[model samples]
Target: MSTPFPSDETAKETPASVSKPIKSAENASLVDSSVALGFPEGGFTAWGTVLGACLIQFCGFGYTSAYGVFQDFYTQTYLTNSTPSAIAWIGSVNAFLVLSVGVVSGRMVDRGAFYPLMKIGCLLQCLFLFILSLAKPDGYYQIFLSQGVGFGIAIGLTNIPSIAIVSHHFQRCRAVAMGIVVAGSSLGAILHPVILNNLINRRLGFANGVRASATLNSGLLFIANLLMRTRIPPQLNAVSYTRILKNSSRDGAYICACVAMTAFEFGYFFEVFYLQLDSTLHGLSEGFSFYSLTILSFGSFIGRLTAGVVSAYVGIPNTVVGSLLISSAVIFAMIGLQSAVSVAVIAASYGLFSGNFIALMGPLVSYLTPENSHIGARMGIMFAISSVGSLLGAPICGAFLTSHYIWWKAAVFAGSVATGGCIALVFMQVILKMRQKASSVCSKEAGV
Candidate 1:
């Protein structure tokens, strides 16, 4: 029964081969190389990584959070006759660009391309904002092209890289870290309206107010660049382009998540802009509208934090589905209410769901993807689809409002979309459960 292979006793007695030493050296070299490339064995401190993630989020998402301010001003001052749907496209384009570019940029981050992209994104974002500052009231097209397209690209490039970096730096505490980071968007949402309102109500006028906000945002973006300068470790093997296009079970979840998110975006953007419009129409003080939005943002901040902690225990998918259901119910309730207090409740409720959905997305995407390699691209695709919803939601809702339909009718529209999203999430959960069961069965059969 002797074979050409050495016996166990003989192998034990044999001198270790030269390859053993070479392999040991290679492993040591890899560890050293990883360290040199900033791949800390234990990763970055959770607090520091979260802070960096928050800064990036502030710069990238603040613009999104600030859309209400812009939409209000644009409608009232520059484009009074413009349809809500039409005005939505500007913000939609911005949102789309922010998301669409993420696909490529995310892959770049997974490939160790974060730093350069971050630098370029920061510069371009600042430049675009500066250009946006110079936009004339009449220059709607330029504003759409510059602020929407340019800013979108910059945010997309910056956002995904920072998010991926956080994922690289943390695992167990990731949901909490992501929550803290995503809360920056709510912070921006809280501040942007107040800043815009103060600026507009002051002698400075809307243009000056926008310029001031843009200047401050530019500085914040620079700070984000400085704070978010971590490098990612390269993958051992590069993923082929074809693989990027292939749909997996995870991709189904991603698509469902994206679709749900899109519906949320549609409803959210419509409500924010329309709330302001309704407030103005009802002759409420600008302060009231601003304060209402602040309250919503505050609720969102709390919601994100709560969802993050809850997701750790209840799981992201379950939390997301629950949040969507709550959001849907709130939207349905909002339809029957007319008072300012009721509207504020609706806003706050919407914020809670919005924050939960957004904060969960990164972690969910991580769970669904084969590798973290295409996090950016997948995020981009998700957002791009969501942007389509945003682009259309406002205008469609506006059309409903302008056509002599009751304001509550618009709520119905939004509620219906959100309900559809909730249904999608349910299906996504079923698919996930089935897959998990199948995996368990396979493992049992394999005796491991």
Candidate 2:
């Protein structure tokens, strides 16, 4: 006689009882684990995560993009006799710090040390901005040291950790999430200048305008810090820096990519400075340069959003390549057009190109590296190294401009750099493909 539940011996022989209980138990266990993990039953919280990431990116990267406005104001009002290169250092250092500090900060976040670092960084950034606000006319060095260097350090600490947390919170819709987050920087770039322009025109002057902007940024950062808590479990192990560097292998292509990025930074910064300077030279009123920058920022905002959607489909490397090529063409075109239409075109093109590059860099580093663990260090190295270009590009261009007003030459220089950047990206793609093929071959061989 058979029992209500078949005996193991009988089940093995009967096949009816053999599979059902085991399958039921397995399904029950899976449901239990899913409940424990707290992951949504299906799909991901894409919208919420993307919104959070966007807010953080807007605050962290927005100020960085808006540096062009400060660069223009400083050069024209306070540092008139200072070399463009000299002034460029302030922005370069800020950018460098933002990029370089990621190595330590990224590891810290991985190690569960995000809160203290972020708090300190936020406070320091706010203090520096306040210090910059108090700067006297011709206090170029003070502003540079305070806003550029100080703010750079602050951003470096905040950026990677904030981004890392976003990665932990979402899985399926990461690209869209990242794109939305990064677009905040473009938004900031667009909005900040309008505010600054209003204040400057209202007779607040550059110092007062900057101070007000700084206060607003500081308040926003303070709120951001409050909201920047981690939503994921910390990594159990520290990421090995040596391994990260080893994998990044200072190959010819990698070096070339760095060079191209540097050149891009230089050209980008030069154009930013030149736009305002040109407005002045063409006899536009003080407020006009800010308006032009606002236009450029608006273009950048649209560009970043477009790049996100495009990169998602065409591939990040391809998107980067396409953007660089288009940017080069735009720079050359800007040389001849003097009409408002031409200026708007140039501004929009610059914004689009710059935004695409910025959005692409995060994915590009991932594409280049072997593991995601070292993303922070690799990014830091990239930023630190590329900053040399930022340091020199403007100065060299500025030196040429000092003797005579050859704005077209600067545009040519920009175009050439962008073209080279496109070439470097092509090589990077080739290397990545080869590496993937090698990886696949090794796996197959091991299986055999």
TM-score top scorer = 1
Distance (Å) between predicted and true CA of 15, model 1? Answer: 24
Model 1: per-residue Cα lDDT at residue 152: 87
* Model 1, CA-based lDDT: 0.66
- Return the TM-score for candidate 1, rounded to 2 decimals: 0.80
Candidate 2 on 222-332: residue-level lDDT in tens?
Answer: 666655444344444454667755666666556656666766776676666566656656665666656787787777777766766888899887888788778768767
Q: How many clashing residue pairs appear in each of the predictions shown?
A: 5, 2
Candidate 1 lDDT by residue in tens digits, 1-448? 0000000110012133322222332233232213322223243454566676677777677657667777777777876666655676787777666766766786676555667898898888878877876777667787888877888888888776676666554445554555567667677778777777787655577667667867787777776655654432344444454555565423676678778887887677666666666665556667786676677777777786777688989998998888888887787775655567876887788878777866676567666666554554455556656767766777777777663436787878888998899998998898789989999999999996
Question: In candidate 2, how many clashes are counted?
Answer: 2
